[model samples]
Target: MPCDLEMGLDNNEDGNGSPETKKIGGVEEEDGDESVGLSRKMSEASICAAEDDEDEEGRKIELGPQCTLKEQLEKDKDDESLRRWKEQLLGSVDIAAVGETLEPEVKILSLAIRTPGRPDIVLQVPESGNPKGLWFTLKEGSRYSLIFTFQVSNNIVAGLKYANTVWKTGVKVDSSKEMLGTFSPQEEPYTHEMPEDTTPSGIFARGSYSARTKFVDDDDKCYLEINYTFDIRKDWQSS
Candidate 1:
């Protein structure tokens, strides 16, 4: 898929190269599926086909918010609470599940680009327990988009609520720390286990999504991530 032309475009001109008379500063253009934030999730168009029609091919997927956890947290300056929560999550993130120490931070200067022959995101249907197809891009600097529907297992939703509660209660930012921290770490890390209640209530089973292109340390390597939370409790449904 092509990255939106507006990905890094200056707003001062139109597609035809005519200067825009508007002088608005800090003005963000509304993306076709604009509800998703800086990290675009999946587009509304693709979302409809995948969730509503049960046609899995309609959902295209990609890798992630490729920045080191730290950079991802810092990018959103306006959401102070979210920034802090992200930092805490990053500080405690376990990559490989083998206790490899994550780099404290990632800088564009450190990323090395090399061609790799593989697809990133894979979409699957739980009922089939098999992947439909892998999401791929023909080039490095391209945008990938898709719609995703997950049965929000109760355990996952509970974890989200707990995390939100922790972030909302008595959190503070400390500029001097090498890695940001929020609530104290629990003795045991949370599990990604689904609970018995995590079934399709038609409430949190499916929904619309959108996303934008993301570059991995380079200005060209692109990826995407979910920009907004789909609570499944209220707004979940096929688009």
Candidate 2:
């Protein structure tokens, strides 16, 4: 059975001239046994049983009333996704449940960028905002960090197949990949740094820049893919 997968590009800019940050928050999983190693697929009966148990345990928590309108809207979208996933899983056991999960295996809550000797800066990537694209300015020859904060719903072993940034001209800027080890139902935050010496200066760089990431589960299947774009310029702030 083919894996269930969903892919989308999220890019939003902060009208206030702040750096833009894109957030993809949701659980993604394939049909498999988490305890018996990667290739062993879970039986339909077992999955249905698990679903029943979860349903009996009550629904997942909902967003609080204090959330902003945008937050509420995002929550609504997630809820709709969850509902669709449940329907798909319950409707057919023969089909491999790709994006459908009894519970979210992993969800990316937020992404941020940080510079050396400076506090982490939250990019303003709204659900629906400006379309001029997200912008970020970095000091030439300075190291920068890309941070990803996520939530894991179950214990699972996962790794990044690849995480890289590239220019519109097709030149690769920076990239990294490694096993993430075992994670349980908790928040896991990771930081990847771009070396000051290795990174190209935005002043001389032309065209837009984007970061692409692919995440795989223990089964070595790509469950989630994320792409975000932004412009890098010497005088972007003045424009």
**Winning candidate number (TM-score):** 2
All candidates' lDDT scores? 0.24, 0.37
lDDT value, residue 11 of candidate 1: 19
Candidate 2 deviates by what RMSD? 17.5
Candidate 2 whole-model C-alpha lDDT, 0 to 1: 0.37
What's each prediction's TM-score?
A: 0.21, 0.44
Error of 2 at 170 (Å): 4.0
- In model 1, where is the ten-residue run with the lowest total lDDT? 173-182
Per-candidate clashes, comma-separated: 7, 1
Identify the runs in model 2 with alpha carbons over 4 angstroms from their true place: 1-104, 124-132, 160-162, 171-175, 187-198, 220-224, 235-239
Model 2 residue pairs with clashes: 4-98
Model 2 lDDT per residue over 53-159, tens place: 22344753221123221222233354556445433322322223322232226655555666666776565433332224454554343445555555554332233
Return the lDDT, model 1, position 134.
24
Candidate 1 root-mean-square deviation in Å? 21.6
